[model samples]
Target: MILHRVAKENYNLLYSIGLTGYGVGMVLVPLFAEFLRQAYGWRGGLLIISALMANIIPVGMAIKFESHKNSRQRNGFQSVPSSPQGCNEGTESNSSTSQDTKGDSSDEIGVVRTIANSLRQSDFYMDPVFNVVFGVTFAYNMVWSGWHSFLVPHALQRGISVRNTIIITFAAAIGNTFSRVAAGFLTNSLVKPVTLFLFATILNIAAILCDVYFDNYYAMLVTTCISAMSIGGRSVLNQLVVRDRASPEKFDVAYAVDQLSVGFGLFLGGYLCGMIADHFSSYDATFKLLACIDVIVLLLIVLVRYRPKSNPA
Candidate 1:
């Protein structure tokens, strides 16, 4: 929200950089969890993590910048008539009355009515463009979440030691970081996110398909790093996919809907992967499933590009 407001049209770069915080957290949490586990045990680790999570309340409260409408209302003196003192007094009285009415209207609306009104304003459910972007988010999260969850485990199953598997995970995170930063520049200039995503999808599908054929650790490492870049690239592009179509003022709606897709998709994808793992004798089958999910994402995003919107109703 703050990024959109601050960057306006230059949102892609800053937003993508901001998103690297997640990738950084992914890298940090495993180290933190491992250290905390050895030192504090699982129960104590959970308690500490919960305490850390509580900081979000204060962090969220810190973003108390003025809203667009509030800024305009507060700075509306530019439109004042320069005629006379009486006219100026009248304008001041009317402005005061309007501000008071705003407060009174909010009080009269009640919480439920206010929420309903906010929903009507958001148009999250009704906007067809947003619906497609939302679907893309959901689909991509399904594959990406499953991929992240399984990467280390699958590497372990391939006879890589637990310590070595962590290296592979680290490599993936590095790729993620690199790709996100690169995406910031790319989105601002030469490449359309859709084209970048398509390329990433192809690489991702190929990496998964060829995983079984890797002859050694280096082969697996290279594949994983490159594949991770694609994963990371998609992560950055996902929100930009929505950003390109919506105005900055509508960013909250876009962010909310996009995140709603992410949560649901992550849940559903992880569940499906769990079911697949339970059914199959090998984890390789789950990679195939992830590939198929990416195919669905590809189709959906292609639709996003080509789908007509002559009548947005």
Candidate 2:
């Protein structure tokens, strides 16, 4: 909702910064968890986290919704007034008050009607652009969930030590942080978001291929960073695509629907990847299959029309 208030050119930048925070959290949380465990044990750590969660309520309350009319007023663009007819001052004042009341009531009715219409509309599900974005988002989430669930186990199986695995994870988080910020700038300055999304998908496919084929510790570490960079920009890109494809009034609904698809993908991806590994007796085969799915995601991205309201900055 806050993002909907921002200009289109800056959306990716803001979204990327948000992703960078997530990357930072991924790196920081493990270190913090280890410290808390050492200092006060797991029960104390859980209590601390529970207490911290309460802060979110106040933070959420601080976010104020700015209406479009208020935004225009702040910009000094007031509504034009009609010419006054030859009437007594008392009659004019009464007429103005009645008009204001009618206007307010009509606005309320219009809002309710739009919501009712949206509830009955199947056009959103049938839209070609929506279908493409939905498919790509689902695929991306599935791949991401699978990688997160299996990457550590896969590394351990390949004979990497616990310390080196942690180092690799740290390296990936660093790559993810930088890449998300860079992706935002790149999307605004160099390429259409859809084009950037396609490139990200390609990077993911390459990273998965490398993970499957490489046995060397350094090589696997590089693949890990590549995969992280690829995953970092995905959520931001998903937001950009949905905003571009849907009307401003429908953005919240569209995003909610997209998130639902993503949740399903995450569940299916994690389960299916584990099943594949069990059947093949290796993570390598599972990654190879993921790479194939990424190819399909890339193709879907290619089909999505990049019709933004404004040109790239």
Candidate 3:
């Protein structure tokens, strides 16, 4: 019961954070980008980003402090139901075996055991589909981050106009924003989590090919829309999978693990695409490589199942 309450509380907090952060950030970036360009020329980009970084550092510190507090709570004294709660002292005595007595310190012990307990039973491990959904979400995030960080610069190096690049970017962001809002609504209504994942996989693959096949203004806009839409849809889908599949007690752990994939994806995408785009004179080659990756990841998503374990809810 405590776990269930904690899970619900966490879900509400995280959902609000995601919505507000993405919504406000997206809305502000175009304006900020324009302001920087006007004020500092090309260097405005650097200045604006630096200012944002300045803002982030303090907020990040606060978050780190809170995270430290939570970690301490998780690692320190453990709680159990009292006798009046129907968990008798004798029951605890019976369960506390030699192994429990052998534990070096209550605070230091149970770390491994706790993790094992969380995932030990059929209630803990995710369904096969959940695995695939997580993988696909991770791969797509890498691709999306790669596109945002490197693709436009590559386009400019290949002689694409600055105005067109901005337009493409704006269009993509607009598509993504609408899709994200729509996805939130739909997840509560029409779409099942797994079905949304499948759709996201298809559209994301299509987005990659858009860069490969089309290089002009109109194609850029369309391809950007595809890319943005897929990512937007997948954002909600990924969360839904965790919510549906994970037991309430383990939801936080599961979601945290899933988000680690996003971090790795961002790192890999930046490094890999940066290396490839730099190595090749043409951005076309980079797009082609990413396209291949997209295909492989899409197939993987399709093959993976989405059902949760068949034990207690």
Candidate 4:
């Protein structure tokens, strides 16, 4: 919903901030958890974290919607008239015309009814761009979730100390934070989001290979950092792809559908990767599999017919 309201130019930046917040949480939570647990015990520490989570309510409340009229005027865009009850007149007109032509009396109801009907239309699912976006999004989420879920365990299995693993993870979190913001800036100033996304995918493959073969602490640290950056960039890049392909009116629904893909990927990726690791008796095979999945994601991204609204700098 927030993405629908913002100008496309700012989408990458705002989304990057959101991703950065996640990275910050990843870094800070572990750092604070032990201290909090030592001071207040596990239950009390968890209670404190829960209390902190409530802060999001106030933050959400702070996001006020801009009036459509004001937004249109500010953007120097023409205002489409609204019906007396605040429904978009153009939408109503189209809906009415379609209803009359098709003799669909069910759609002649209220504004909400018409909107709901439009939302349920199969056109979105049939869109090639949407399908490609969904595929890449799903693949990216799968690899990301699987890696995060198992990276630490893999490190320990390979004879890395818990202390070094924690340090590597913290470094990765920092890289994640910076990379998300850098992706936004680069997208805005240096490259198309799709190009950046492709670059990230290639970088991730390298990182995965390093993780599979390297045993040195420094090498693992480098791999974690590179992997974090590449993975972090994907989050923003995927949203930009969705924004570029979706019609303005359908952006919210398209994004929601994309999120569903992410959820599916997260669940399946983690489970499948774990299963593969168990069967192979090594995380190396899991990393290689993830790299293969990234190749699929890269191909899907290439198939997207992206048309950016602005010229790339």
Q: What is the Å distance of residue 205 in model 3 from its true position?
A: 1.3
**Which runs in model 2 stand beyond 4 Å of their true positions?**
6-9, 67-127, 305-313
Cα deviation of 253 in candidate 2 (Å)? 1.3
> What overall lDDT goes with each candidate model?
0.80, 0.82, 0.67, 0.83
RMSD of each: 7.5, 7.2, 7.7, 7.1
Ranking by TM-score: 4, 2, 1, 3
Candidate 3, run of 10 with poorest lDDT: 1-10
Assess every candidate by TM-score: 0.73, 0.78, 0.68, 0.79
How do the residues 89-114 of candidate 1 rate in per-residue lDDT, one tens digit apiece? Answer: 76778799778869876787787797
Candidate 4 TM-score over all chains jointly: 0.79
Give residue 273's lDDT in candidate 2 (0 to 100): 92
List the pairs of residues colliding in candidate 3.
129-305, 129-306
Per-residue lDDT over 89-153 for candidate 2, one digit per residue giving the tens place of the 0 to 100 score: 88778799888979988999999999888655543644645667888889888888888899899
